[model samples]
Target: MLEVGQSTWRHLTLAQRARLLGRLHATVSASAEEWADIAATSKELEPGHPLRGEEWLGGPYAVLTALEAYRTSVRALAQGESPLARVRTDAAPGGRLCARVFPLTAIDGLLLSGYSGEVWFEPGVTEAEARRNAGLGQLTPTTPAGVGVVLGAGNVSAIPVLDVLYELMASNRVVLLKVNPTQDALLPVFERALAPLIEPGFVRIVRGAGDVGAYLTTHRSISHVHITGATPTFDAIVWGPGANGERRRRANRPLLKKPITAELGGVSPIIIVPGEWSTADLRFHAEHVVTMRLQNSGHNCIAGQIVLLSADWPQREAFLDALRVAYEAAPRRSAWYPRSDEKLQGAASDYPDASWCADGTRALIEIGAGDDATALETTEYFAPILGVVSLPGTGQEFLDAAVAHANEKLTGTLGANLLIDPAAEAALGDGFERAIADLHYGAIAINSWTAFGFLIPTLTWGGFPGSTLQNVVSGMGVVHNALLLDRVERSLTRGPFRPLPRSVSALAGPGRFSVLPKPSWFVTSRTGATVSEGFTRFRMDGNWARLMGTLVQAFRA
Candidate 1:
């Protein structure tokens, strides 16, 4: 779709460049004011309001907060001021460490810290050189006014927005971001927050279903495409074969010649070793494994599908049973999107006796099978279905079997998770760490869910492209934490041996009622607003009393 003709890549004069940069900044800043107004209006049309459900709320504070944080961080780096030393350089292969800050909870306010070294992968750079490279991120790249089309996914609220941010901020490309019909309502929020870009022909939005997406992807004026959706969707765009659409598929090559980057779904796995676990530890991890299966009603790309069990160990049965019980008690969320129940039922029919968390409205079907372990573990169902598989030993045999099973069976190379106890780690030593390296995945999580890796701003997210483009799951390139240059396909993961009692993380068990709403309220609403505001103010004003107040409120939460 991108036609790089002779007229492309025009350069602006120095004066013109200065004017454009100032205008861009001013435009984005003024747009924030519009977003604030939208937020105020949306607040008035609350739950009891007639238009509440019909009109999606435009609470642009989150977007505004993100913009402010980005501006602050970039400005600071440009001015040679970094607090956390996240940017560092040395005379090694991966010499510089570059940290990118992405605030997950903007309800509190977005704050950027870190990014302290040479972000580039310079081979023989000193610490001073590394710092200088990081400072370059502060310098804004200029755009030549070409249209970039974005094929957005419906799952994450931030993916599309951030994709646009990447093209705009990093690539300096003008964008036309198309929203998935499933999340059509969020378009208004984007319009409000990115008003300046929208007004200046720098950004635009086109909303519809598959047809709209197809058009945009193949559009003549579109220079580039970025997608956050299913692998099937990407295939359709590049190769084309949906609903008897054979013309493009037969072509064998892509119709649109423009470069495309996609972050597709994956069938993520989580392996559990049955080594030295008390009943409590077993239960805690059981919940952890299942929580990954249940997050976002089990529609997530990184949700755990294959449960790698230590076959020879006795604790495997106990953990499985605990997981079943947890599922029985866990709330059955509304499938959330269409065709969810059909997929759930299809998965259940294969193994009828699989455990189900049902409450008339919805159900999470758990598939347990000892025979044909590989068969059930191959695909991502995009619904709440867990396939249990077992390996037959501990130590080297256990690790070997788990890794072998995953490699032999799983349909994805995007990500994997391993829950290893400290004692197990000590026993295996180098073998354990080597197994982690050997686990063929783009991202791996040790002792926790793999989703955290994607959520954390410090880590990169993407999978190997493999031989052909069609088979790739997670995707070829990485986006988050762009400061790192020579990243070996990111392993953004987290783990904590001892459990935190009140974390809303997937591992914790909250009986009958969900703790997330409470936690969200604690962080987002007026009760927490004062403290949050105080913390932000402290960065600029530095009042000790205000700082204490902020700390006290955070502690209470």
Candidate 2:
């Protein structure tokens, strides 16, 4: 299959490739409900369960958004223009070029008003360098280079699909995808959605356990590999397993000769800067934090595992109390991932003083200064075990401390988030941007969750550059960057503090305000499922009526 694809793939024109993607977009949209159903069934989310929204927004809707981004980019290339041709660029704090990704279309401005995001290039990448180097492979697609293998992720349905699209569109390679065993039930839906590529022999989907993966990885035709699983799996494939693996690692001898990339889970952090807040502010952010930690039953690789707070802040206790309320408020879902139930029990047994939900599905441990946070900082617990640490200082001092701690203490550099009040943020001024520049993370968010980097197609998703094979912090390389940017340093996003209605307060001026409602992706949303369904349909056809219906659901949520 690889040999045949390479033979015919390069012969097809850019317009032909774009049309193939267009066909894939339609079929995937048609199968969106079945894909969501597969995900819902995985976690035992029965019909009419409010958490069904998790399947739609996080599962199918996310893939739909990626398809739209990639389709647009490919179409642009077919029209003799680079994907970055219409993009606006500016200088960050260090003169490194910043690509303005959000609000690329008029609809973006209306849908996510008051939101701003940018991708900061590596140091010394001037604007010209950035533009000229953008869309490296596709800008000069002379041939379909080779075959790549994608080891799909079990936790998220979109990971494998997006990876396949990246290999085909960005790298100009055909793909042979192997779905994780945990998500094998969704194989039929994936096959149906990807029929366009499958029929043309441009893409193929296979299923199996460890042996199947080992077979494909060692195949003579496979030129590159990518995985969205655990770090141990990467090490096992790169080096031999068990004692021999450690020996090979110590001697700098790897078993695999080909290049591989990954997006492994990490102990992500959420820093809450000290500031004055109204009652509504605490409640809103409390639920926001809950969504960050418990979304998809905390199976997300970018889930918020640790939260940093200021010990001297007057509202620390109040916000913590609010968080407790929010945690207990969310309904329980089954732990379908391997050993998730045992992991949840482990959290309760490990931390005696930890508070838990009624069903023990969520655990919160409070760690004061000098308390041991070894497990929280170094380990990526698959269960919903949240750790709260109180650092010293306030204002810019606290911000600096939080950045230093997250960079120096946390195990992985995949993602980190900061939540600061609008007024308090204005007070920080230059110190705030400086702190963001200093954080050693692939993706950073302000007043938002880092998972946004995963959903946004233009933003590069990976860990901070510098991790080696021996100590793979958050794995290596990147995907889902539809812009095909090179020398990407990190993705930075800032959003409105509150949702609509309350967001109309005096603080929400034109310069900095978002009219977005409580997003349907929020687990606590009342109409999340309905809103996500509407958004999925809207993405399918871009119909005005469908969008109005989705807006109604969002407002209700």
Candidate 3:
């Protein structure tokens, strides 16, 4: 299957590629409900629960969006225009180019509300260089780079499909995707949805355990490899295991020579810049913090694990109290992802002083100040455990110290989030912007959760670029960058301090300008599935009736 795809993919013309992507878009749209159902069942989510919306967005909707973007790029290429010509670009500091990719139309703004995102090219990437390298492998049809192996992630259903899309569309490579054993129940669904690529011999989906993955990774026919998994897995694959792995890593020797790229997990942080706050503000952000930790049952790589707070802030205790209330209010979700229980147990054992909040089905362990090398700070607890660290400083001093800590002390450079009151932001002024510039993360979100950077297809998702085999912190390379810009350093997504009317933000407060019926990300909401599906449909087709229905459902919740 891989050899056939390797041979046939190179011959596909731009028009043919566009058509193939269009077919994929149709397949996903048609299979949306079934796909969502399978994922919900696998994750133990109730059939009609709003949390099923997570499956829809992370599964079919994500694939459909990527297909549309890839199709647009290929179609533009066929029309003799730059694939990135539609993007608006500006110059950032150090000669980097910032390309605004989201909210491409006014309809996007109307649908998303108060949200905008951009990808910054690497330093010294001029406008001309960006335009020149925008399409890279797709601009002019090139020979296939042989069969590529994609080791899929078990947590997010969309990740495997999107990884396949990136291989085919961005790099013009054929793919052999190995589904993670944890979620291999969806093999039939993948076979159906990816039939277009399979029929054309451009892609192949295989179900597998670790042994199967090991065989495929070492196969001579496979020219390159990409994985969305942990750093240890990458190490085991590239440098053997245990003592030998450490030896090879130190000697900079890799067993597998073929090029490998990965999107690994991280201990993501949310730096809260202290400021005066109203009760409404506190409530709004309390919900925001809870959503950040509890979303996807806390299995997400970009979940807000470490929350940095200012020790001198007067509202610190008030905000913490509100956070506790919000956390307890959210019903415990099923820990369905692989190893979630084990990870949670490890965290509990390491920090016996940790405050435990569990109702059997879900858990939220809070760790207070401890040594920097403690498990709570150093380990990527892929569960509902959040560590709160208080730093001394106020205003710029706080922001500067926080930035330094986040950049240096955090485990991975995958992504980070910052929550600051608008007044506090105004007070910091240029210092806030400077602080943002200094964050050594692949994606950063301001006044919002970092998950937005991953959810938005246009934003480049990966580490901050310079990782190697020996020091693969968050792995290497980028994905989900629809625009195909070269040398992308990071993605920064900014949102309004307060929720906009009709916005689906988790940060919406009691009296603030909120228009949603209920927060779609909340697993406790009875109508979560309906609201999620409605919002997704509205985004895909912009149907007013669906939007109205979703709003009504939200209100009912």
Candidate 4:
């Protein structure tokens, strides 16, 4: 199949592929509810469970949103125009080009109120250079065609399918996707949703565990390999496993000659810049931090594992208390990903002084100056455990220490987050953006979770691209970059520090009044399931009525 498609690849126009994506949108829409339900059930979410919304947003809503994003880019590419022209792009400080991807249209503004994101081109990339290089595979209507193997991610419903989409549209390759065993139940739905690509020999879905992935990656027919798994899996694929593999790895010799890329899991951090705060500020940001840790039962690659707080801040202890309260009070869900029980137990052993739930399923640890944070510093727990570490400073001193801690100690460079009081950020002058620029992460979310970078299709969703076969920290390349952007560095997702009703208050960053309530992605949200269902419908057809209904649900959320 790949050979046939490779022969015909040059003539496969962007417009035709655009229609294929259109069909995918329809098929996925028709079965969107079933898709979400199956995923939710597979992940131990019972009917009517609050976290069912997680599946809705992660599965259908995420893919549907990607389809819409790709639609815009494909149409422009079909017309021989730059998709970057469709958005607001300009030069930012340090001579890098920044494309404001979110709030793209008026509809985007209305539906995604108070949220915005930008993809920044790497340092030294001029506006003209980035614009010229934006579309390589898409604009040329030509590509080096071959087969790519996609090793699906188990924790997130959207990741595997989205990676396949990136392969077809951006890399101009047909995909042989091996479903993650933990998410195997969604394979049939994936077949149906992806039938447009499947029928055309552009894609094929296979199911299996590590052995199958290894087989596919090494197959002579495969040209490139991509996976969203751990670093060990990458090592096994790159150098081959066992003592021989270790020797090969140490020697920087790779067994597989083919090019490979990955978005390996990381020990992500949330740097909280200290400032004067009111009771409302503490509560709102507490929920923000809790939502970051507990979402998807902490199975997210970008989950906030360790929090860096300022020790000298007067409200530091108060804020930590609020975090403990929120962490305990947040709605509990099953840690559904494979091996979660063992991982959580390891975390419990590492932080013996940490607070734990009665069921021993969740933990929150506070690292004092004298304590060892070895586990938190080095491991991607990927469980319902969050650590709080206080640095000895305030203002820029605190910011400097936190950024150094995250960049120096963390396991992966995939994602990092910063939660700052707007006033404190203002006081930092140019230092805030400087700190953001200094952080060595692929995606940086301000006052929001880095998972937003994953959900937003246009944003480059991978780690900073310097890792080699020798040191597989986060992987080599990025995916879901529908615009076909190049010279990429990172994505920034900025959101208002407060939600609506409260956002109008004096403490809600003064002038920033948001229509957004608590995000539907929040585990504590009441209307996420319904809001995301409506969002999927709206993305399917652009029905204003459906969007209006979704807005109602969001307001309720």
Model 4, 314-366: lDDT tens digits are 99889988888888888877887888988888987888888896266689889
- What is candidate 2's CA lDDT for residue 541? 82
Scored against the true structure, residue 126 in model 1 reaches a CA lDDT of: 47
Q: Each model's TM-score, in the order given? A: 0.72, 0.97, 0.94, 0.97
Every model: Cα RMSD to truth: 7.7, 1.5, 2.9, 1.6
lDDT by residue (1-557, candidate 1, tens digit) is 12231122123332342344344444444453333333224334222322221111112222333344445444454445642245332232233332323322332222211101112222244455434444222243333536778887675555676667556544556778898776675567677556655654567887998888888888788777888877777777777766543455555556557778777766777888667777767766776776677655666788788777776787766887887776665444455656787877776666666555655332343444444444456656788777777667888788978888776678777778888766677788778766765677766777656665654433456674352454555665655443323333345444454343423233443111112211111111223333434443453344677766665554453
Clashing residue pairs found in predicted model 1: 86-116, 87-116, 87-117, 88-117, 118-130, 311-391
Higher-ranked by TM-score: 2 or 3: 2
Candidate ordering by TM-score (highest first)? 2, 4, 3, 1
Whole-model Cα lDDT per candidate? 0.55, 0.84, 0.80, 0.84
Q: Model 4's lDDT to the true fold?
A: 0.84
Candidate 3 per-residue lDDT, tens place, 360-467, comes to 443444544554435666788878887788899889999999999888888999989998876688788778887888889999998767777787777789988889
Model 2 pairs in collision = 114-513
Clashes of 1: 6
In model 3, residue pairs whose N, Cα or C atoms come closer than 3 Å (at least 3 residues apart or on different chains), thus clashing, are 49-529, 50-528, 50-529, 517-554, 517-555
- Give the C-alpha lDDT of model 3: 0.80
Q: What is the lDDT of candidate 2?
A: 0.84
Global lDDT for candidate 1? 0.55
Model 2 misplacement above 4 A? 506-511
lDDT of 2 by residue, 1-557 (tens): 76687667777777777777788889999999889988888888899999887777767777777777777887887787777889988878766788999868777677667777799999998877787777767776766669999999998888899999888877888899999998899999999999888877778999999989988998889999999888999999888789999999999899888988888878889999998888998998988888898988888888999999999899999999999999898878866789887777777666777887847668989986566888778878877888998899999999999999998898889989889887888898889888999999999988888887787777888888887888887878888888888888999887888778767763634225657778777888999888777777777788988798778778888
